[model samples]
Target: MATPAAYDGLISHAGSLFWIQSGEGPDQLVTWTASDGVSLAAPQGFELGNEIHAYGGGAVTASASGVWGVSSKDGRIYRLTSDKAEPLTGHTGDQLGDLVVRGETVLALREGTNGDQLVDVDTSTGHVRVLLQSSSFLSSPRPGPGYVAWLSWDADHMPWDSTQLWVARYDDRSGGSLGTALLVAGGHSESVLEPQWGPDGSLYFMSDRTGWLNLYRWDGERTYAVAPMAADCAAAPWELGYRSYTPLENRKIAMRARRDLEDHLLLVDESGHSETFQLPFTAIKPYLCTIDNAVAMIAATPTTAPAVVLVERDGSYAVIAGQEPSQDEVRQPERHSADGIDFLLHPPIDAETTWRAPVIVRAHPGPTDEISLRRDPQLDFFTRHGFAVADVDYRGSTGHGRAFRSSLYGNWGSYDVEDCAAVARHLITLGITLAGEVFICGSSAGGYTALRAATTTGPFRAASARSPIIDPKRWEASVPRFQRAHATALATGATAVSSAAIECPVLLVHGLHDPITSAQDTAALASDLKTRGADHELLMLDTSSHTLAAPDLAAQVLDAELRFFRRMLDQSESAKRT
Candidate 1:
């Protein structure tokens, strides 16, 4: 019952025994200790500079500390306690993203893959302290010594338009700067994102006006309402890399759903109390694992990928099943080529502490690069709501090799956006990630590499870009002729650019019955991000087309993207003292 690639990743030491972020090299993070199930010692050469597929957080702590991660050229923060690995550089802005950890200090929350430095590193002292920036897009870093709550959007085009809800509190031993950001709850026709912070401070997030997708709380002083809109929701508050574990107790906030029905393990305390643990296993894919005292996850099917059975704590479930999931010796088989590139790396199972998981970069669609991870129960509803997903086949996108899928013929968006931003900055130098809270999704040519990763090279925080072909001269002057001969080499190297140099906040879902990315090219790409202003939001749905992965339109696009990233990511600890 363990031969689906051996079903890697359930608990090889507890963290990432066999976690993956999609194929290729230099992005190590492979563990397997407890005395070898197949051997995976790890650590050597360790190089991820200039970054390629980078995304590793900053902590294995109980051992490795002060971590923050991300790459494809920058956004690092390291301070590994034992085994010496100090690499904190303040903040220079290249790649590093939505990350957290305040106790021993390591909160890299960034977004400037090009402009807007949201810095916060100190991992002992590489000292990069900025705290805020323009055209923002942050989330992760909820509670703090004095204060810290994030979820912002000063308006990029319409990115959930007119958004706000940012909390701050300087002097956490002197890291000052965040005097203004009051406005707890804006108009929110499109914003009020994911502000977590549970344990007791009570922040819990995810909102969508009243339309659906619910789960809210604020109590740093006000904002109440607790759980209702379920286009498919379950007490929002993710961290475990996508949405795997958010157990907070007393005030409660458990989760592990399949939305409407079927896959269950839902909780939601604080007053909302929404119960359901039922599990005999039908969960096509669910993974909200790890919360200590009790809360583990892993449910699979699509030929199979299970390890699940551990529901414990009065409830009962300690079923081991074959015994797989181990690969976090912090992998290093060592291999990387450049002539047309050849890479290799499939190790990342930090054995728990908090090693991070979810990567799923996978984007081909450019001339059918087909790479596969097929199944689709919304990928098991994003691994039963806890994500450790990964998949990427870049080089112009396809299954692999054909001159690497014709090298995007004339460089269609430069080697599949530099091999999907070099395999997410090579798994952020192999720590597995503490920064780049990437969700660089795709659809039409991987939604043009998740909309060219919000204007070429990002420190990504969420990009659910479905049906995006992104201006290849407006898709070869409006497609047609046998699909414009398979998009004449990506509209002769795509030209009509201008999603206003894209400054992050996009949620653009499409399909008013999309035939081939046309609902007037997503309403003229949301009217060219409102004539080049940029911070967009589109959502068309209805009869919906262009397989958004399906399963009831990927459960109404993961419930308006966890309520448009929980109102862009709330940070009000009750306005932190406004």
Candidate 2:
């Protein structure tokens, strides 16, 4: 069976809803209505994915007339009608995304060589005009009645590290005029995200000032924290157009909260009283918006694949679109009872096996991101083949509080490597797997962790890293200007663990066109391994990017890695018998 496709960019229009269906081919804009079940708004090969923040989201927005989106083939915005798509903005070198339509003008965030800024485009004339500029990054341009609000930050801080919320008087409908942007909230150590205009004309946003991302509102005077909780109501601003919370009618709010890697849907009343609803889902995408009395989001559980679901205020939900996983395809992972860290242990699917199953400890990408309790087809492939798996939530991962996530500050490789080793040792002590059969694998940041783990005294027989960061010092040059400090902090006290110390065989996979992590780093590491006479192999993909959006390439890489693992395990077992 093929892996399920994911959905995002949920937007509610005039009695109709639309979203972007990704993962299969080029992302297609899908529209749904009560009259028609579902239909494609854009033609085939008209992809909506963009590269604004590297992992772009919110690339599509709906106006009264039609839908406007950033074309994946080009960075220009297009007005996608039912028949054909027409360009709304002329081509510039700047990457445009996070589109929001306001009357006859469409506002978008443009990332250029100068910096990131907000620009307005005429729907008819396709004329682009700069609205705001002189910021390292800008996002979430929410246009209200007579004003527009947005979030901005400098080169010294990431969006999640520190951001400033601003509001300005914008009157583009009457000859296009914009006022001086005034600071609303943020600019401290707190990270603010998703500045949106509420139904009551107030500006509502999420802030992490109290160590947790909670909801707050600005009533044109003072900002008030509404329904404050110890859980994170917002995800890291990795992309644009993520909405963790949305305002409902009658001063109520519908939000999603993250605690211990599990997602909970919440309804908060005006008095700060919250009602948590129990659902089978463990992870819910932040692409959420309220429609009438119900809320729509893409949600997924450990056993169930992601689906676009419309949940009512009464805790009842219906699947709008997307596939659900079958019972045989789902595998539940048990939480490990570690002392202080969080880890999940997934057993082999075949309980009738007599031999101890080989274990693969996973280190998820975005050393800052955590592995959610959602159904992953790749991990399930290992389990179905009689191999156990452990997903480690190393230090610096989200879903925990800020302190836990900030623990890896200036200590990236050390903390993550130690955490993976600890989990592996714990599994071995419990007799879940033998020493020679344990393996470690990861992608991107996790790839760095897996490579570092092989240098430690861990019980890992082999390591596989996809698009891994081999040298932290070399990685600093390729990151964004705002993330240089983070890269420096990660490389400061980091020691270059030699491949000679790693006795286990290694498999390295990388995409030649990866913009985030350079392919040269992987090639250099492979060279070092070869010079040191270390057992290693490198696979290079020509057309794949950092995320490997192509399904065929991803499947091929997975099959290659699995085959490498089986070969290494067989060799180790043969050596033991000899």
The best candidate in terms of lDDT: 2
| Range of the 10 consecutive residues with the lowest summed lDDT in candidate 2 | 323-332
- Quote the lDDT for 480 in model 1: 36
lDDT at 431, model 2: 77
Best by TM-score: 2
How far residue 312's Cα lies from its native spot in candidate 1, in Å, is: 3.9
lDDT value, candidate 2, whole model: 0.82
For candidate 2, lDDT tens digit of each residue in 353-421? 343689999999877777788877788788888888899888888877777777887898889888888
Worst 10 residues of 1 by lDDT: 50-59
TM-score list, all predictions: 0.28, 0.96
> How many backbone clashes are present in model 2?
0
What is the RMSD of candidate 1?
24.2
* Residue 457 local lDDT, model 1: 50
